[model samples]
Target chain A: MISVLNAGNWAEQYSTIGERAFLSITMTVVGIVIVVFVLTLLTVVVSLMSRLINGKPGGKETTAPKRQPEAAAEKAAVEPAGSSAEPGASASERASETDGALIAVITAAVSLALSDSSQPSAGFKIRRIRRV
Target chain B: MNSIVDFFNAFSETINRLWQGSGFTNIQLSQIGMILIAFVLLYLAIVKKFEPLLLLPIAFGMILTNMPMAGIINMNFYDPDFITSLGYPENTIFAYREVLNEGGLLDYIYLGIKLGIYPPLIFLGIGALTDFGPLLANPRSLLLGAAAQIGIFVAFIGALLLGFTPWEAASIGIIGGADGPTAIFVTKTLAPHLLGAVAVAAYAYMALVPVIQPPIMRALTTKKERGVVMEQLRPVSSTEKIIFPIAVTILVALIIPDALTLVGMLMLGNLLRESKVCERLVKTAGNELLNIVTIFLGVSVGATATASSFLTSRTLLIIGLGVIAFGFGTAAGVLLGKLMYRLSGGKVNPLIGSAGVSAVPMAARVSQKVGSDENPSNFLLMHAMGPNVAGVIGSAVAAGILLALLR
Candidate 1:
């Protein structure tokens, strides 16, 4: 393990390092701080991206089909507790014509919403049909 | 009658000769002292449940190697012929390494500690289990993590004052990191002779964190301060989780390449965990594999703490400095937390800052527990976890820094 490089170079190496110690230490400290700062900045950006991709989607609803007026009247028919039962036939007959017209418009709007995305269109469809 | 008398005389003479020739005819006091120490460690592990996972095996190894005539870890390196003739009985031979690799029995045990392999692998297991969500939610906790590194440097200066070489001082200072793997890694690179002492000190303090940290926690903060409830952590998205380790790795590598092995492996483990695809590898790394390595690692480390090497004044100094380092580190973290609390308008609980000691989840859980005692609804676990995990990274980086500087 003989060294061909002379004693002069060894002294030179020592002298060069002595002059550069301050610079080297300062650079190291500054470099570490910058690196830490950058890493953290990157972490924040990535965190935001992941949250956006994985967050719950909002402001959407589903719509169900509307019932016909006669069907609606029939559907709400309350049976008496007694052994005998009635369909409330007189009431159904009274409202059938007007109710059927309203029901037809509601059905069109409800089906239109349902045909679109099943999410959150019901509220809009209901409002439109009620105005009609 | 004359023949019987002569035979009895001859038997007595033979017994006297045998007694004179044997080496251990009288027990030495130093051997007695070592046995007592071994018994104490054993009792502590078994009865008191003090780091029983490591202490028990270590205690057992100490007892075995300490026995006077056992040659359990003893070696005769002076004689080449004796080394050459070593092998198992001809009837049975295991697939062990060649004599050079195998060395002597004690030499083999010493390898586990010397190579610095086992502890970092343990860290990999720890990294796999650690969740960095809290860190992602509140990135400011990184400051507390950085603050805790003050203890390491403080101890380093103290070691230098005590006439230790720069490398030895660096190894001693890493005990303040309160990270066993970091301590082991640094010492392995910097001061191999002091490995046993430094490792023992780090683990001992870690086990004592419950006892050691509370007084410091209470001393540093007011009751009102401890009681403060932190704001809820915003949800950390999966994309952020994936990028966190990658970003840390690149930034850390560019700044201090020496840290890459520890930091790289650690973040890689975390990446595997958060990526959510490598469930099988994660399971193995975290549980079965970790346990197996820990046992071997603990025993091998204990075996290295032989009486001849360990019973020195330097060991005492190392232990003392280790305690000081851990205490100072806890203080720095807590003080930083207090500063953050004031800066955040009391939104942050200062107690969570103590988690920056790099004891991982235990220190974090303690912060949460202590906080909840003051305010039942207060939740600091999530907040504490950020610094806790960050401290692990910071300490590893610090260890790497010391390694590079001292080397």
Candidate 2:
């Protein structure tokens, strides 16, 4: 009979289909979120721990002008003693320069707390300081 | 001669029958009115550039449905005894006749809008385009995002008091989040009847964020507070950048189980983007896939706007309440921004907090503009993005809460 073929009469079957679709979508979404969250947490914890244990100190604030003293000190340490040492007032100047240098590095490290890391200019490289 | 005359008479009778069924009827005044209304919507979307890609198709669908005698979207195909039997049952003692189910173009659109499929896929595109660097640099911005979701709950309660059933109220409240996808998802599940009104309101307010947010922002903060310049952000490591979307997915899932699908799809897209491994998938999802879905979603949703069903007092109430919800949401974000501004000793720009409304780059851009107005050199785009992305997550979470509570 035509009545037997009427799909409208199969309300319960259609309802079950709709319900199953909803359940499938919901489960897939939840599963993905959980997986992504756990992995992200692991990465954050691991990176922070590794950085704390092995990362270098004072990674920022090494301006070109500020690094001159460190370079001069390294130059003095490497130079030969017989090479016309015009080391007169330069010795006191270098000593005072070392004191100033120590103060600058300390100040730079402390200021890191106030600076926003969103800006690339906020951080300084120690390698640049050593090169100068 | 008699036979020929009989054939001509029969032909005339057939013509009369067709004429009776083919043209406009007196009862089609409402359909005409709806078509005119749809024209106005189309004009607003096209000329004003107010979500044109979506509104245009929806308006066209509305027009199509309102056309008299057009069976473009007929719902009844299997009715027997077509001339006498009605498509649906009619409850009446005297007539005891079947009621014509009046299959209209709107029925097809109803299918897509009612299923709750389109908006979340849009979220997937949003996730792909979103970068979590700013949020990672300032993890605390997540709190601002969470705070912005106050609009959803508040509106939910308000809608309930307005006499909508729990499901209806929850669907109505999501409009405050100013997220079209979230609005669609919630409405499809809750009050499928109000889906069109809710969808329109959500997208309308999203496009109008710049106009709506400014007055509230100016009223809430002092000139000095607005002028405050936030410090530049630290460079977020690639590792931390990759970890952030994942962490958020976990934390959100653990807190609210229902929000997973919306949030999960969004974060999965984000993860694909951040991981640097699935560039092709990311690009396709963000652009091609998203665009195709938008077209389908828009046309289908528009089809739901049948003249009889959509032209009701309840639709007007949803539109009115939708504005209130968005205003409250914007205010909540600004207030939280102000709190953070105080806590961080004026180092934080409260302007960025307003980005927590889940309107994405628009809300975030508004924050940047407001900040620049205060101090021409103050750049808050990157900072605003943190809370802006957070707002997206927060709205999804709030939507989940509504689903659990209302459904």
Candidate 3:
């Protein structure tokens, strides 16, 4: 409804009902055509953007990063107070999972300590971490 | 004794002037009627809780404008007749000092509406607030958005058959899009006279989306179709989110330049929100700036409901046509949904298509509610949101088309 120009000559066209009806029907068709055409084109554009950004609808980003944190967290949460569930699992595997757990704990404590700041991670530094 | 009689006569004359000048005497039956209508709207907004954010200011502005001889709203200033009376050519520019000296406050405020500023700004806020993720997840929902716009044309034909000019008919037809800003934007430019009637009708029906949409939705689709559960949308990437507004703005602007203002500002706001770098600007645009514009917009727009303009048969016809527009828009969306249901081998729920009318979360919520009633497990809100957001673009595009052809 943002009219680009003032209503100059456009007002008061087609005085007769028959003429107006014809104009309306014509405008209706034009309106539908342009609207559908524009949005359908937009749909294509958005779809193209999606493919470019994500590579595929649910590609590597969807499958990889989402599961790693949860799997690591579950292992860390479940293994600490009891026997490790998987006898076939390597010691390095347990150590790797525990490293993620240690990172989460340190980050949490730093986040809490700097909670007064708008960005809690701004001041603190992890410096370095390596397996002992 | 003659001096005493003279004093009494002078006093009587003074009393006569006071009586003539006071609103108590100047109040016309039509003004009273408009005031009563304003009161009824207030009741609806307060008691019925129908879009009070805009309605409250609008109804108050209505009362303020209708007060006899208050001159709070000199709508005459906008009339061609009044412009001519001011000793300038009807379309002359640079009447600034004259208008500032002669016009009422509401007349000045109405400039924002007349020049098409507020609605697009409101759209900027809407864009900042809207998430196009649902829409991008399912691009085909755009068709439902496009299909729903058939109602605008249907209503246009209805208005034309009823004897409205093409310009006025186009203004009324946008009510079918179920987007208030777009409706006001069109009506202000094309048929500024009908702004009040059209705005009232548009907002009233928007608030009643839950009531009006469900019946049309239920009637159009079967129990099984309504019960169909849509799949969860894919996880949209941040990059996709950031790119969407930019892409839409470019495409829509290139094709429909008339749509650029409303659509451009909308996409800019969305871009700001999605970019995540302009939080302060987004907050102001979406929250504080939007609130200020809404107040000004509702008040000035309400003041346009002057007795002479609003109390006409044409106004009533516009209102009647508005509901019809809403109904047609909803039914068209659902009918298309049913068709999609068939085409997609029943994987699609027809209920979500009704959200294509752009009532935003309201239509989407109705879809969810109706679907849940049919089957407790179905969650159509996200799926419905795809079409719901697309309807915003669809309706804006429709308004642009109407403006392009008619204006």
Candidate 4:
């Protein structure tokens, strides 16, 4: 195929169609490689910065687990005894703490069920005790 | 009888002046064609609302320039060989001198574009408005951005096969970058003649991002892939944000010196926004300064589309190639995104890959929209933004490489 446009009118760098084609391919390959390399370097830069500032890869984990406020509140309510139990605590002590937490949670749920949303402070009502 | 004869002569003289001085005598078929094209652009801008900020001004400037004998813009003054053809040594100042002495209103406004001032200033505004947190939180998105630039080089090769010189090919290829300013900047530097066609193609394609990108995104990814809910991006610290601009600027300076003007301005704006100390400057850069540059840039670029220059077979080729380049770019980004998805074990949503073409929040929004279509609960906007911002840097880098090599 013939060239559609002339090379630089003054310079006439590529007079032949074959040379233009070859140069075109070469230039394209070079451009893609460099673009990818530079951007990849930036990727590394951002990742390094994230690790340096937040002490993790990509800073995916923040300093606090404040992602879900409601979930955190629920966990706090359910794991009151577990929070106090250390790794060094005895198994019997841990079991007793767990039992105490379980009773408190059940009591709280009963109170909430008996209360009205407008009157949230209405205390627990022990109308009946039926073990299922 | 003598007084009546004098009155009739005066009336005849006045009619001759009006007929000769009006545009009607000077208008050519070519100018009429360009005016019609401008009207079409106006319809698209006003009614269809396709990048109205850019299209409206460009269409108006096109009308102004295409008006026969408007004398506002003289293309010969901007032609590279025009000065030399006039038996004078060619220099930019010399050209400006000619315009200053004999040029019109637009000839002065075009100075901003010819001197390559407007694009970098526009980049600064974009930097100020941008939030790099999405990109910073997910560094891998940078790869998708880089991958999207493959479209540029691919289009370069395609343009070469179509018989354009290397410089012309490079200018055309940048349309794939889908960055309007970068395309204009490269065209002005490498192939000023094609500036009109290339700018129109780039801006038109960018505005059509939503239309051009979705089908490709759907064809490449399965419903399951599109439906994948990406993990939330980690919070980027203010410190990281501050460091990012500095790091990118330094990197561009060290690696591609030609890119310094654009990348440097971009980083400076980002730094101003991130530092929070320069709130006053950031507000101005992001809003006032940007708006000013946009008007100048769009109008002057549009004015470059004179009848002879724009009504060429080459312009048609450029428009066709521009869309092809965009498709290639979108595909490359999506493919890389799919690669990341497989590597990350289904954690990464491949749809965000389409945003790597750098239409900014629009491309990101497209990712979100497509993903939402597949899974209503999935919101991919933030995730897509990571690649979207990276695409900005990637395109600038690609432009730098092209200018350095081609020039």
Winner on lDDT (2 vs 3) = 3
Could you say which candidate leads in DockQ?
4
For model 3, what is the alpha-carbon lDDT of residue B237? Answer: 77
- For residues B52-99, what per-residue lDDT tens digits would candidate 1 score against the true structure? 887777777666666665555543331224434665444222213442
Q: What is each model's TM-score for chain A?
A: 0.28, 0.32, 0.36, 0.42
True contacts kept of each: 0.06, 0.00, 0.64, 0.70
Cα lDDT tens digits for candidate 2, B43-117: 989899887878887788777766767766642222233423543344211111322255444444444444556
Give DockQ for candidates 1 onward, in order.
Answer: 0.05, 0.03, 0.27, 0.35
Per-residue C-alpha lDDT of model 2 across residues A12-127, encoded as one tens digit per residue: 43245444344323432443343234333433543453355436221111234446667766766777543434453367667657867876886677567547565555444443
Off by over 4 Å in 4: A1-17, A59-132, B91-94
| Candidate that would win on TM-score | 4
Least lDDT summed over 10 consecutive residues: which range in candidate 2 chain B? B91-100
- Candidate 1: regions farther than 4 A off: A1-132, B1-28, B74-102
Model 3 Cα lDDT, one tens digit per residue, B89-204: 65643245555887778878878888889999999999999999888888889999999998899999999889777778889999999999999999987888899999999998
**For model 3, which pairs clash?**
none
For the record, the alpha-carbon RMSD of candidate 2 to the native fold, in angstroms, is 15.3
Chain B alone, candidate 4, TM-score of 0.98
Question: Candidate 1 chain B — worst ten consecutive residues by lDDT sum?
Answer: B90-99
